[model samples]
Target: MKTLILFVALVGYTQALSYSDVLEEEWNRFQLDYTKFYQTEDEALLRRLIFVDNKRRIDKHNRRFMAGKESYEMGVNQFTDLLPKEFQSQMLSSLNITEAEGLIDFRYTAPRDVDPPSSIDWRARGAVTPVMDQGENCGSCWAFATTGTLEGQTFLKTGRLVSLSEQNLIDCSNDAPYYNEGCKGGLELNALMYIMHKGIDTESSYPYRGTQQKCRFNSSNIGASVEAFIGVSGEANLAAATAFHGPVSVRVDSEGMQSYKGGVYNNPNCSDEILDHAMVVVGYGNDKSGGDYWLVKNSWGTTWGENGYIRMSRNRNNQCGIATIAVFPIV
Candidate 1:
């Protein structure tokens, strides 16, 4: 009996060691160091949980890989390993965004020559598209997407790039009827409405805190304004709108987006079930293999996707709900 007990303990120890080795390799590959979360032995259990969670993620990634069906790379990066699910839902969900019942109807007066070229990138056209940014842990993707489209439009109209304030919308947009939740979430449409009714301030005036705060917008410090907004449909309309405007904000079923690394992201699991996350479509192009893709600008910073953006599979009948809830602000 003593020998059997000893043998069981040895097996348990080997399993733990194997898990530790695999966790270390994943951390190294993703350039993470969870040791920073340690201050006490009780707190150190977080490391164990993280290690376990990373293993779970690895198993999931491997399954996707083994199926020979992965269109994007999966990694144990910040988004996949750290961000909480409740926070992601709060950040992404604006409460039945696909309803489209109260959507505003506005006539567009854009340049007649709106037919986009084979491909167009507003960043390369001397537009002041700012560098990629992070929203931390707040359910503030709505604010980020709102500010991104605003920044792009400001540059397109004035020929000057200016980083607008997501913090401003996070603080002040609660006044919007549609923006019921402050930090928890807000609709990009409501954000555009706030900008139209009350102009937005710059990032310098109201830096992002990634959380809810009392409204403190300065009217004198307004930086950008949206003259009107337009709803777009299909690949052709979205592409044309992007070329005529700058960036278009769209909501997508991004439940599977965190694990994505690069390539034309087309996960069979992600469907148009609902619109959860808001993003800006900056441009579109076809790959070498003629796979059409939408260049989407994400707010998760530069380390997340192909440098803070994703080339999602486009023209696949609106795969991943890319154009389901799409719109762009007219500056």
Candidate 2:
């Protein structure tokens, strides 16, 4: 019986070592996948701790998803090493409504009363440009959102789908009045105003650096110019405007979207009042299984969500404030 007990203890020790080895392999794989670098070993250890915790939560969430308890799934991504607060500080920023002193209201430029289709995708219509990555630790989602909306509108007006410059807005719009602070944070309406005053250039002409620098906007290389922009209100109005005009820029609470993988996102923890991130509403549709959803375009790269997009719960009391401060450029 002593030999039997010794054999059981050996098996337990072997299993424990195997678990540790697997965890170390996962950490190594994560670092390699995201190209993670640290200034010191201590910092790397701290980040590993955070990443492991995030991985645990992701596994738990995905388990719930597989069990049909969750509407969406969570997975390890580039954001796995950062805490929620760290991720928010590095990636998210809310729009300041108090700064909007002079901008067109939705009531004035609202689309004519028309029966919007049950579903509409601007991508299928050859209006939206390809999804873009905002890069690491940059809160330039507003710039991407602005460019996306303009690209769609430009396509509709000029019959050309041109990728506009986010770097142009990131650099130039940071000055007084516009207040678009590059990677720090910015407002979408402020960005629109900047585009109206100084026409933006093409993405190829002014590539994205994901950093704040001196304004180098060349008016001669302007890609698309807009006469004015309007701030839309309500989900119905937002849907109509997107269907009629094209993609619309909007803000939302992206607090729990860090590890989001796919499916109709319906986070009960997400607040509708706290709009923290800017994205474009590319389209909307009713999922046969997941119910109604707003197809949103995120700038977190193609590896983040559904090919750099998220299907947010829509028409459910303005889930995540998607329709709170929507705006679109008029070409």
Which has the greatest lDDT?
Answer: 2
Residue 203 in model 1: lDDT: 89
lDDT per residue as tens, model 1, 28-120: 554344224447876556555664685687578757765766666665556544545644654465547544536757633445654567777
Candidate 2 backbone collisions, by pair: none
List the candidates' TM-scores in order.
Answer: 0.82, 0.91
TM-score, candidate 1, is 0.82
TM-score of 2: 0.91
lDDT of 1: 0.73
Best by TM-score: 2
lDDT for model 2, please. Answer: 0.87
Local distance difference test values of all predictions, in order: 0.73, 0.87
Model 1 deviation from native, Cα RMSD in Å: 6.5
